[model samples]
Target: MSKIEEVKAKVEIGKTKLVPALVQEALDEGSTPAMILQAMVDSMGVVGDKFSKGEIFVPEMLIAAKAMAKGVDVLRPLLAGDSETSLGTCIIGTVAGDLHDIGKNLVAMMIESAGFTMVDLGVDVPAEKFVEAIKENERVTLVACSGLLTTTMPALKEAVQTIKAAYPDQKVIVGGAPVTPEYAAEIGADGFAPDAGSAAVKAKEIISV
Candidate 1:
């Protein structure tokens, strides 16, 4: 198999050593940092699909993310340390009144692993914060809302409406335990994600389409 394909397979199998070793190989072969980054990102995309389908669980996802991060760390400086220019920017957070952040954090990592620059606002993010981030960061095209609880889920709707009202072209994507695609549509969100891996895919879809 080709080197990139080998790296992708290793990532799918959740091998922690795969990325770092393949990164070294890529560097030795005089592959550009950009090429290596794209390979790693593609691997993460594969991992995301497997995760969404339940072929891989959270622990495996974390392991693959860690590997991807290691590869990125090695290539960061060589790429001029510009994560945003290389990977499109994205804003993500747990919606207001929701203190739980495990799911949000996972989604952030998965997105980052897929080579999207992430602005993680953490938990309890108000609707205004989402709008402010979108306005300030024009590079940020995708906004992800996560709420683990039913009570705090309304924040997703509020944030989506507030952002869309301010920028009619904006796209808001909602996820978390209590969120559904129908509910996302009802709230005027652009998309819904069933899991963190799917969230990464959904973010890419919104940005590309």
Candidate 2:
């Protein structure tokens, strides 16, 4: 099989020790960094789908994400471009009372790879902190709020409303296990992404509008 395919397979199985080198080898074998990165991201999608199907649990998903992260570290420099021409800053965090960050971190990585400077507020972040981040950062174009629990969904709404109220035109995107597109619209988010890859695409789409 091709080196890129090997990279994807290793990432899917959560081979943390092998993915980085395989990613670098794929890069050396005339595979562009973006192509290798996409392979790893696709692996994560497969992992997520497996998780959704109950074929894998949180530990499995976390390890797969870790493996993908390792592969990404190998491609980060090649994936990132000039910051001055960036799409703009994206403020991302898991909403208040939610400590889940694997999904948040994955979205941050993908969005950063898509060329936005990311200001990650970390987990259990209050809604006011998002506004504070936007106000403090220049060219802030997107705010992404994540909530993995049904219980924290309200925190997600509070975050979107707070940011929108503070800056009427501010673009907000919301997601996590329980967040649906309809609920996102109901809660005032400009966009909703079901996964990290789509989050990057949606972030770019939001900023271009």
lDDT of each: 0.82, 0.85
lDDT of 1 by residue, 1-209 (tens): 76666666776666777677887787887777788787778888888888889988999889888887877777877877565444567899888898999999999998787667789999999999988998788577788888889997678889889889887888778888888899999999999989988888888788773
lDDT of 2 by residue, 1-209 (tens): 99999999998888999999998889889998867876775676677667656788767766777887788778778767644436789999999999999999978866765557789999999999999999899989999999999999999999999999999999999999999999999999999998776777788788873
TM-score of 2: 0.70
Q: What is the lDDT of candidate 1?
A: 0.82
**Candidate whose lDDT is highest:** 2
- Separately for all candidates shown, the number of backbone clashes (residues 3 or more apart, or on different chains) is 0, 0
TM-score, structure 1 vs. true: 0.90
lDDT of candidate 1 at residue 132, scale 0 to 100:
92
lDDT of 1 at 105: 93
